[model samples]
Target: MSNKKEQLFDIGLFKRLFQFIKPYNLVFSGVFGSVILIAILGVSTPYLLQQAIDTNLTNRVSEGFLFFILLMVGLLFAEFVFQLLFIYYSGWLGQSVVKDIRVKLFNHLLRFKMKYYDNSSVGVLITRSVTDMERIADIFGQGLFMIFRDFLTMIVVSIVMVIMSWKLSLIVFAMLPVVLYATKVFQKYMKTAFEEVRNEVSNLNSFVQERITGMKILQLFAREDVENENFKTINGRHKKGWLKTIWYNSIFFPIPDFCASAVTGLVVWYGGLASVVDGTATQGVLFAFVMFIPKLFRPLRQIADKFNALQMGMVAANRVFKVIDTTSQIDDTGKHIAKNFKGDINFENVFFNYVEDEAVLKGISFNVKAGETVAIVGATGAGKSTIINLLNRFYEIKSGVISIDNFDIKEVTLHSLRSQIAVVLQDVFLFADTILNNITLNNPEITEAQVEQAARDIGVHDFISSLPNGYHYNVKERGVMLSSGQRQLISFLRAYVTNPSILVLDEATSSVDSYSEQLIQNATDKITKGRTSIVIAHRLATIKKADKIIVMDAGNIMEQGTHEELLQIKNGYYKNLYEVQFLKEEVA
Candidate 1:
């Protein structure tokens, strides 16, 4: 369900991830040194226990006993301090790395073309940014640190164990491979379970987000119960997936301890025999081996858990890479500016398809002079919106050339090209911020005067002033707190504030009441006065006064003329749409 094959992560990916941490090399070095100290302290504690038992308990020297006790206390204190340093710095490194990744991922996401968002789910995107980041950070903050400490402790203890008595050490260490094999086998199942859980969580998140965002529509349509049932079904699936993971953990968590206990029993029995036969293994040595035995199993278990964390991190890393690795289909050369764009647009022999299977715009050729107002009227799926998208460079034309003021759009930087065009589409999106911020989104340098002017021109100035905090009034998410008319007006102001050379209005007035529509239409007239405007809508009243009307059908222009001329034809798409809207007005 990941839609990606599970694969092993190699050094190259980690190296790239490590580059983020390289900037904090000092912190890493501190953590590394502290971990080494902790490992030394851990390995030394068992030897100190041996020294206490052999030198103090056997000798019956009060001074030796006191000295051994004090040394043990001091070493314990040192270990605690080293651990504190290790944890603090490791946590710092993890948090810093998370911050850096989030910033880089966000910046890269912004650079992606529109098509990326079109193909990806919003829920998954948010999850990658938020949930996946935490997983990656945990790998470093907890998993990697555990691996370092446990592995070093295990290594140092192994060397000490062999130096103390190789025969006894071998007996205790024999169970390591069995424990490792068991963990490896169980880890495969855990990974599968975790991946399933992650996928189900993403699905559930997408479902909740989609429904909550459309709650008003669901309620209006009286489908709340239907949506609730659908959500319940999805949530149940997610719960089952998580329960499988819990079941896996319940089995996997206890095996390492069982293996360690079995090894400890073997060590005690074998060391007693060796001591009885030739006094080869002392009681103190057996005590030390007992301590080292538990220490050995501790790292093996940690290694397993850390390995699991690394795998989860890799899964998340793959998603982040998937987003960053995607190449934008809309490639801009970052040059070829139309410095003094007169908005003379030309689409010559243009052909486009959202996908290769079918064409949306076929052999479309047209031109719009500077400062001309062009109204496009067509039936649904007649490629009206596709034309606007092509002009905006949202999608690449399969085979054609679109030029602005004789400069090819593909040859120019998308930023520069888009900076010169302002579009207000039918589905307006408002950020969760104040109304003022939404209006002057692109022009953050806009003065209070400019904001007020744009708001007044769009006829929302009075309504905004009536709000409790005037322009500072919160819009809520997607402007849900305001009426549809208010949202449309704010979107219009946003487009108007830019004052672009070319303006596109795609049914900007379609969903609003007649009064709001008329007010927006008037603002549209003012904004389009000194700029080229392309209006795509079905409402005939909105474009009746346009300088030119383009009537399209099946991706080809059927008529091109003024509204009066198109109406004179009596059989064009424009005439039919006009008749329908006229009848509707009469009925109302």
Candidate 2:
């Protein structure tokens, strides 16, 4: 939203951008040569016309006229050939550069931490990858080549014009500053307008995408009409931003036309007077000057158009750069290892906050032995999930040490650390992929037998086997093809195949029917036998058999004991929750 003009478009950005084209230098060189040839052919046209006027016409020589006509035809043919070659190479380079840019941007996104995704919207990132990349594509496809071709043509035409008649050339050259100044002013407005268009586009995409994803809630609440109005308001703003950009370009294209006309009128008046009074500048030279003015203005117009495209490209590039430039708060300290993980986790005085000055997890201390099963119970926002997130280093604690097997998690590489921990959340996300791929997502090296075993252990293998394609059956986006219990079962298999040293189940069985829940609970019991497991339960009875159960409130542990021990107290919050759940079950 800030003024883009205030930011320096320095040589460093250019250098980094050009580095992507280094591999295609040969193609670019061919493109460059063709552009130069095209410029030469254009400049030669005016001289050919002048010769036809002065000698071929006045002498009434048929052969000279034929030769002049053939020469013009040949130059025209050559120009067309070069133009074709330029088109081919420019397209090749544009697609190649854009492909590399997208790859780098996506890889950069992977390196960012969970905090980045927590605050950013899916629509904004999608727009950056899709819309912004297309804007940059224009820079390579038309913008860069146009600037090169036109600037060369302009310089060559100007030098030849001056050579033909310095006096007339000076009249035209005097108008150069007018063109430059006008372009400078137009560029400032274009830059701002284009940036506004891009920002608005991002916002509009976010609004539409979020609304579409949340349509279920809207329909449930019967607020479709309200959402539609809200969407119209944001969409109207996008329309206005795009129209302002178009208005700026409408003003931009005319400045060059006005400058060219003013210069041409002056040239004809001055050169015609010199020819009559001094006979110094010939009528043919004056004629060539008139013809050359158009040649100059054509490229001038192209340069202006390219400048406009360049400003938009720069706006997109700046947004992409901003994303790539951000440093993730979590960092690897070069102490990563692929093995020797025993999952002896200890959280010592851990504190955290999603925002500054408001702690979500406050000075909590706990330890899980190498193969202990621990359960955390709390009301919503009581920091049960926050503790698990910190243990996995999804977020770094503000002040504390989380260690696995006596090694602080901060010392391990993110990939190595993550490989040892697996999480199965209440909301399971399944890509539109084969069932086999979903289960083996955590360990691609897993064999068919291992994947099948993991699925069987999680009680999803029978469901998968019932499908026409069995393990190869496709689960559509967000696992829409599967039932909720099936989706949760697949998520369980995804975790189980990793053979993780530690596992965190946050309301993992909350969505399943009682029968499916019992199946998942049986699997959880087997899987946690020798692994350090942490279960955050919404249904208190689910964790009744856990080796240790901790009751929490407002980011603090109110009691730490077994479920039966907490029940015996009969006066705490845990006792109230236990009595309510038992009563509900008995009545059912």
Evaluated against the true structure, the overall lDDT of model 2 is 0.82
Q: Give the per-residue lDDT digits (tens) of candidate 2, residues 209-297.
A: 99888888999999999999998999999999989878877877887888888888988888889889997777778888888888888
Model 2 segments beyond 4 Å from truth?
1-4, 7-12, 258-287, 334-340, 586-588
Q: In model 1, what are the clashing residue pairs, if there are any?
A: none
Regions of model 1 farther than 4 Å from truth: 1-9, 269-278, 338-340, 583-588
Q: What is the C-alpha lDDT of each candidate?
A: 0.83, 0.82
TM-score for every candidate vs. truth?
0.93, 0.91
Q: Pick the candidate with the highest TM-score.
A: 1
The deviation in Å at residue 77 for candidate 1 is 1.7
Give residue 149's error in model 1 in angstroms.
1.8
**lDDT per residue as tens, model 1, 226-323:** 98899899999999998987787678768889988888898899998887789888878889999998899978887877877876776677667777
Clash numbers, per candidate: 0, 0
